[model samples]
Each structure stands twice: as structure tokens, then as C-alpha cells.
Target: MSEVPAYLREGYITPDELFRKIPKPSEERLRARPVAVPECPQEIPCAPCREICPTNAISMPTPNDLPVVDYEKCIGCSLCVQICPGLAFFMVHYVGDKARITMPHELLPLPERGEEVVLLNRIGEPVGKGKVLTVVPREKTKGDTPIIIVEVPIELAWDVRAIKVVRE
Candidate 1:
């Protein structure tokens, strides 16, 4: 097994973990239902998600308000996930008859490339199985979070939004 990175071993809290604790936007407030996007609650000054959006899909317009994503134009490339300082971005793709979710994972002893893992939904519920498709470890990403791409059944794609490695 690979050694866990010092950050993970030192008990540091990652942005993804922190963001997951925030309540998701209520369905009534959303114009587009079913598509999950980060609705930042805090008055943080970070706007990487807005600046990094290739399609200008995410808009901050101002610094203090939450960033808004235009899902219609958003490509779900996960560029926001790679740039957000808060690690608050995630991508869900219901394509080719299967649902695929991409999130920021910074744990050490990272899952082996192509390993199978159990997928968890936004509510942290185990909904189905998924296979690791990519592990992005880049310098710009603070190298703390690894971008995990998990593939699940098409029917459960949207429902299975997060993943937890199945420990032996």
C-alpha cells in the first residue's frame, strides 16, 4: 500500500470534506432541479470557480455572494473542482447511459488506478458500485486532493454522487 500523504496523515481537513458538511441548496430555490451545484453559504472571498470556468458558466459578479453556475453551459469538465480554493466543486455527468461523478479526494493511500470502489450519494448514502477511472494529482490542485472519477450504473448515476474506497 502507498503511504498516506503527510497532510492526510497529519489530520488536516480537506476542502471537500468541509464543503460536504454544508447544507445543499433547497430544491425550491433551484431553477434547474436534479443537477447538483455548489451553493456556497459562507461569505468567503474565493472565486476560483468563477474565474476557472471555461464557458463562463460560473458567475460571481461580486465577491461576497455565492457563486452561481449556469448548468446549461457548464461542460462538467471539473475545472472548477481543480481550481476552487474551498474544494467545493463537483461534477456529475449522466452520459452514455451511466452516471459518473467527479469529486476532490485528498486521502493518502489513494485508490489504485482503475480500482473498484463503492459510491456514496450526496447524502453520504451507499447507492452503488463504481470504478476509478482517473486520479488527477496536479500541482495547481494543491496536490492535497486527488480528482476521483467514478463510474456507476446509469440508473443510479445521478443518485450516486460521491464515493468511498472499499477497505479490505
Candidate 2:
């Protein structure tokens, strides 16, 4: 952890900074329901996530501060995910042995439900395979961004942020 992460060096919020901005969720909360994880660690003048949260879970003290989420108030809704301009918000729900990640997808061709897709990390590098659980169409999102829900190994819940559809 000595070397600075790309997010930090690139002027984005670091993992350590994000961790301190929001309270840590308990295992029970993480395992029981979906929580919105804001990967937007930058101090940009953004507040859509805070404004759209129905449960008032996301908050920003000032215009340029990073958004913070109160996991206890988050109702697992993907409103923030769909409305994010930076596409940094993700909904994570942990099941028995797997984790369901709901992420924004703006690709040309979307994957189908039950289709196998390549899991990707923050930098778009292929990490593993995941199964598509659901695909929320663009018409359903506030910002016209479609959302894809994929199921992957529990260990990948934190690492996997995006997906790559392997077409023939």
C-alpha cells in the first residue's frame, strides 16, 4: 500500500479516503441486502447521487465534497447508480455464496439474462467469469443508462466493477 493507487495519483479519491468518508457496514448489513458503494472518490462538484437517494442514504456536506452513504438507510435501489454522471455508484448484494453486482452498462449491445460474461476490474482487465442475473433497460434509468446485474464469486464482489461481453 506504499505506492499511491491510480485513483489518487490521477486526482480521484483514494480507497482509504473513501473508507473514512463513509461508515463501515457490518457483515449482517452487507449479507442481508444491497448497498450502494460510491467509487467516486474525487472532490468534484457533484451531488446527483445525494439528491436522488429516496432513503436519503447519500449525502454531501458541500458542493465539492465526496458523496457518503449511510448503509443503514440505503434501500438497495439503483437510482443513484443510474443517475451517476461518472458511473461510479454500484449496488452490491451478497447472497449465500455469491455476490450480485448492479452496474451501469452503456455498451452498444447488451448481454442477455443468464448469459455468461467476463468479469472486469476497475481498469477493465478481465478477472473472471460471471452470470448475468438481470438487465435493466435504458428507459428505466433516470439518466438513460442501462444497468446490468451480474452474479460472481463472493470474493470478487469488491474487485469486480464492470463486465465484458464475449461475443462470438
The best candidate by TM-score is 2
Task: Look at candidate 1 and tell me the lDDT of residue 5.
Answer: 50
Evaluated at residue 99, the lDDT of candidate 2 is 94
Model 1 bad stretches (over 4 Å): 1-36, 140-143
lDDT of 2 by residue, 1-168 (tens): 598666678655444566776666677888989988888766898898999999888888986997888888999988999999898998888899999999999886899999999998876779999999999899978987899999999988877888988899
lDDT of 1 at 95: 52
Deviation of model 1 at 109, angstroms: 2.3
Q: Model 1: which ten-residue window has the lowest total lDDT?
A: 26-35
Q: Which candidate gets the maximum lDDT versus the true structure? A: 2
Give the Cα lDDT of each candidate. 0.64, 0.86
Candidate 1 lDDT score relative to the true structure: 0.64
Candidate 2 TM-score versus the reference: 0.90
